[model samples]
Target: MLIDMSVTPLSADDRQRYARHLALAEIGEAGQQRLAASSALIIGAGGLGSPAALYLAAAGVGRIGLVDYDSVEASNLQRQVLFTHDDIGAGKAEVARARLLALNPRLAVDAHAVRLGPSNALDIFRRYDVVLDGTDRLAVRYLVNDACVLAGKPLVSCAIHRFEGQAMTYIPGRGPCYRCLHPLAGDALVPSCAEAGVLGVLPGVMGTLQATEAMKVLLGVGEPLLGRLLVYDALAMSFQQFSFQRRANCAVCGDNPTITRLEDDGEATMIEEWTPEELAQQLEGARAGSLLLVDVREPHEWAAGRVPGSVHIPLGTLAARATEIPPDRTPVFICAVGGRSMAACRYFAGGGRPAINLAGGVTGWSAVHGPLPRPEGCQS
Candidate 1:
């Protein structure tokens, strides 16, 4: 067993409560007892944490810690299955604690109704055998992974975006850490679920997989996702596995590692921004001829509606079509929201071109000027 089986002997009630687990040959009495002795710390009591918490609690995990500072909102009812209409406006961690206790009164649930920061992450992580990273924020993801490496604890990290999601496991000295796989300095340029959108049932599927991996890690019964990434697509209803390797120069878990302490990952470099009102004022001023309005949204979005004098340069094709942009005029990038445009701005700025991002993209512009003008043949 992964954990010490010398834990308190299972009572008649535990045997009855986990009768199903006890029946499985892989997770018989000893495995169930191991589960009963193990503890898990789950960050973010939102969509991913909801199902994982429920299953781990019902499966007899002795202790579970939930970390989140936000309160439940009405929109959370769609994917955050741990809360209900009555739970709206309630603290997420506390509500999740109550729900887990109600599911299984034997286990202990710790509700950390505060944000997880570098100062407190290591201390909180040391108490748990494993960590489940359910947070959607990019910086927090790196913090959890790095802290686990420093604390020598196993981490089960999962992320969902739109219709797809990915899960991976990291064990100290066994495999690559999150930084080894994603060497990028920051991931904030990637839009969040709210900035984009997600299928209501997506996190449910991924979080359950997270619970499955956590139990396996506790039981030491099956091969964990160590060195492997599991990607799931709800639209295609398929799963794919990609293998990764430990980097020799990885900053967190490498032979000559540089990062020996916990710190927040640096955010994307700040670029110049222009509000919709500023763009309008510039269009009517003498500098109107000196600006090149570049719409970096997808072709579909561009076809629907766009600014009158803007040029369509999809983000995916922008890098290759750099020559198309005029050298004399300043380029102002715009997208559906600001994320893709920000990325475009950074790209041009890296090439020594002074670029600007529309603060809120087409949505912001439309909000200011009533509605954007559409193409003659556009369907939307």
Candidate 2:
């Protein structure tokens, strides 16, 4: 369906502001009008949602609904570019709504300072034309997918870890749902942002991609990421696309669907709970030669201030270099904060290796051992 860009009815001010868009053959007046008529719901306000929200607002998306229950923190300032230090302790959705409106007052921005769950997802999503999943929790991802399917909405989902990110789109009845690619299991362990440690800029790249996909879906131009996984490697500066097919046995969107109704997998909770003191003792043991410390933080982080004598194998390189780690040693994993290290611990534990997570990670290590020297090129 080719839209007539020149024929879009726009106010004088809107036409002047979106002149660049009007110049594009792919997205002219008709595409801009389509954007003006669409509504989208973004399900998180962290890293991914930050960029996605900013772009959607700037692109003149008619109505945007933001759903988040978190408050801004100092740590979030590193990647959530939409907020400032002053916004800390403020509700992310509310603050984001204010910032987005400031960028484009003509756009309608709705802020819902509540957590999205099975009970509320369908109703919230039904009001929008597209749904974007920017959440980091697994249970929420599943809930968003199910809700989108139930509402017959297209879902644009993205996830980031360290320097890697992945995104896919789920269009009900037209393409595979998230469950088709990742079949859920009772014992399957899902990594949380608090336990996976994502790079600050990683989400920016992936989130922008998601925004691009959403724009394409809205304008009905270009191919959406349906049935395809877009993987990004920031360190190597590479992008890889993999194709997937709908699973007939998918429990949710399958032919004989088992999950016809939305159900909660329980409330969302941060993974890995350990105090600073407990984490210190674990690191001390590793330094005492009784245990091996595997610093899963990036190479630069290891050089900054790692446990006295720890092996530096970045988490992204783990799968390929797993053989380098001796199976005989009891591994104690560490990362910038604690997220990535805990994920590393789980990965090793599942592989039959006795692995322990260093709570609070290098951040906690620095508090106990004094501030260590920053590596040459390592950014704080």
TM-score of each: 0.73, 0.70
Against the hidden true structure, what lDDT does model 1 obtain?
0.84
Clash number by candidate, in order: 0, 4
lDDT per residue, candidate 1, 1-380, as tens digits? 13555688889999899899999999998888888889999999988999999999999999999999878877688999999999988999999999999999989999999777777899999889999999875546877888999999999999998899999999888899888998644443443323557898999999999999999988887999999999999999999999999999988898887778774332222245778899999889998898899998877788879987899888777888988998998888888767678777767765767787887688878877878888667754
Q: What are the lDDT figures for the candidates, one per model?
A: 0.84, 0.78
Model 2 CA lDDT for position 321? 79
User: lDDT for model 2, on a 0 to 1 scale?
Assistant: 0.78
Q: Which candidate is the best by TM-score?
A: 1
State residue 243's C-alpha deviation in candidate 2, in Å.
1.1
* Cα lDDT, model 1, residue 204: 98
